[model samples]
Target: MIPSFRLFPDSASTVSGEVNGFFICMLILCSLMAIGIAALIIYSCLRYHRAHERAIGDQRRYNVPLEVTWTVVPFVLFVGMFVWGARMYFDIERPPDNAISMYVVGKQWMWKIQHPEGQREINTLHIPIGQPVKLTMTSEDVIHSFFVPAFRTKQDVLPGRYTTTWFEASKAGKYHLFCAEYCGTKHSGMIGWIYAMPRKDYQTWLTQGAAEGSMASMGEKYFHQFGCANCHHFNNQGRCPDLRNLYMRPVQISTGETIIADDNYLRESIYDPNAKIVYGFHANIMPNFTGVIQPEQVAEIIAYIKALGPQPGAQEPSNPGTAPSTYGAQKGLAGPGATSISGSEVQER
Candidate 1:
């Protein structure tokens, strides 16, 4: 019996061929440069050796064309490589707007994955072929890396922040998943498999074990459970900033900095409420849930917030006065020092 070996992993992603081609080009270029230099050194030694003890060597100083050709040729090739690599990088980093959103939480010895449809899996991911899948990943403990060789995609998952990577599987099969970063004693055991199925089969699999409802629905439950709805009311009359229609919108902070309300901003707002106070709002009003809420719960809460799509015909405020703010004297939910501050007064601050 004979064993078969492969020089490269299966190319199962849209970008895998491009990655392989770029890598081969670089390998060939470097290999040829090395071989050419070695051969030239050998040829020069043989051609320029002294024939007799009194032989005088040619006193050539320098060749302008030769020097310029070597320098300029390598420079152009390197610049071309840089441009090609940069374009590939941006394409990989930016996920398509229509890509399916998935969540991943890295912990010691395991990869916990959740789909928008509420399907949960440990150490295994099921994705659809020919459809882009964007993974919003973070770590609960230490730094971890999400790597799929077949997809030619790898992104670092770090604690206290979110990082994303996307891939569209071109082939339908099972591919290996690995935690590229060395984590703990079970680092070698931290492995998984990605099952890329056809669209119909993937949809069927989504319906099988999703009894827990969608992530947004579960997030809504947590929204009320944590009393987030008490202040962040749906009617836009809450004592705190109205959370409705906040996702992916520009938010003006107290420091006059405008930032997009993305997943990372939402996560930071939950864990460290005072980090970036919304404009026309007082700092230290919202309690920090750093120790109270887990990372997965935070993700769910952000999902719920994202599910709160933009309000119809909700125009952006022309000035600070028109921005949503707490008004009149209402009973406060945020314990002791809670008091209703008028929108006009907060704007002056």
Candidate 2:
């Protein structure tokens, strides 16, 4: 179907109307102020021309109340606008507890998306109407922005960092998607569509893609492949912190600071392991996977870590006794200068 157009893109997202309303209010306030100031200037210039002898007559020394009115009124109006914007900003940045998460990778000229259910899409995002969706995005090369004018949401996807944005489709339809940042040669061509379908239809679309493995499953394989499981295991023998049930949990670091073990934290731990050492673990033990782990693989590892934790209303895993899936394969991958991770091999300083 041909998408409808208006002075503004269809307010198809939960925040769309709110953002548009805020923008309209700002426009009206600014325009009125501009016109008022212009009119006042014109009237004062014409009425108080030097040629008018009576214009000099009635020159009041000072008007304290009028000055106060201008100062207080604009201050109050701006403060109100600031508060409204701050609230919306927090709402947009902090995804809901029950939000459905997805991944997006921005490359030179295309968007690569991955659904938790193992579905994949190129340059298009499929979301269910009336449900909150959180997108964890990154750039493979340079910077790119994930923007949907209809949703009134835009977030920059940066290289070597993860940025997130969330939105709920209030209306079902196809909306424009653009990489708001200038990436490369084909930056303008880096465009797509966001399809908001009904719950059932969305589910169907999800199943239409590859159904082989979830992000967590692929992460699990990489966890074994990269030998991360050997050190960050469930047992006490491993010096590193146990990743099980670690998501959304506050972890104390050696610097005496407590930080949430979120996606960025995990990424940092992999990229620069010594940046924030875990409270109890010795510094400089974990090896950096900066150049070794690809962006997609890092996402998978995060997915696996997220899966290790309890979801909403779910119970924690009662048993985590299984050995690292690659305990034996370590000898092969961990060649000459490798850290020991097996039960009797790993020990704290």
Candidate 3:
């Protein structure tokens, strides 16, 4: 069982127990060192007291073994701690491939959250337990942070960019959420709750009176509205790189630097368009749509890109009340009357 002690937050995540246990061990080690040093000071003062005014203290200045023992012991302890922390950090940063994706938008005094099924919530988040959930967050205006003490996960939500973080809740319950950043006068009031429910209950909560469309569906519509297909056509020549299957792939930049095309890279390529120029592609062609769209809309665009990639299982339910859906087709992805250039099209050209 996980301990619910006052020294730290409740150990509720998979890594929380291991992390907190290491923390507790370090704390005990430090406390013991402090107490031992204090005791030595008192003992030395009493033993070399000036009660006999003419007593000369022993010149035992350099005990090589004692000095080496203290030095090597702390060094070994520190290296072990560093390795343990590094492994945990690796696990925390890279979410599992089967993890679900969610979006979060931070505003002045509220948080806007969106699930895959297009369920929307303000100042609250609902998630299913025993599954990994990755959250790609951004800010509307200033800087904001998503903090949950129970899950031991906190990531800063910044404007004009994407920050991704993930967590798998170990238990099912309601936990407190706070904006750890001090943005404005109402910073303290920017609080919410994370409800980790059972898987069956979570699916029921998703379909109950909520929108039926997925993020990919909304992103597909946005892709057509912004006229991105004009330059990014399948049989198109040397204008812009084909964006098919671009997520998580490494692209060589103009400066001979290879970087993973993750969420942040995709956001930058859409907003700035000139920051990291592709090695073979020319710059100054794609229009910068920074201020034209909102942060959450960019998230939808990203969702559409990810959906365009290889889908392992069945697709999520689309929005019911909308038009007849032609979703999930990799070819002519913009529906019936369009070119058929897809990721496969890039090779033929």
Q: Which candidate has the highest TM-score of all? A: 1
lDDT of each: 0.80, 0.79, 0.77
- Ranking the candidates on lDDT from highest down gives 1, 2, 3
Task: Return the TM-score for candidate 2, rounded to 2 decimals.
Answer: 0.81
Per-residue CA lDDT of model 2 for 263-321, tens digit only, reads 88888899999998876679888888887998878888898887776553343232111
Expressed as tens digits, the lDDT of each residue in 1-349 for candidate 1 is: 6666768889999899999999999999999999999999999999988799999888899999999998999999999999999988977887865688889999998999988888889999999999999999999999999999999999989999999999999999999999999998998898999999999999999888755877777788888888887887655466678775566656667786666677899999998899988777787778889878877778778877766653222443321211234211111222121222212211100
Q: RMSD, each candidate, Å?
A: 8.2, 9.0, 8.5
* Model 2 accuracy (lDDT, Cα): 0.79
The TM-score-based order of candidates, best leading, equals 1, 2, 3
Candidate 3's error at 12, in angstroms? Answer: 1.2
Reference-based TM-score of each model: 0.85, 0.81, 0.80
Model 3 Cα lDDT, one tens digit per residue, 53-139: 677877778989999999999999899989999998877766665678899999998999988778888999999999989898989
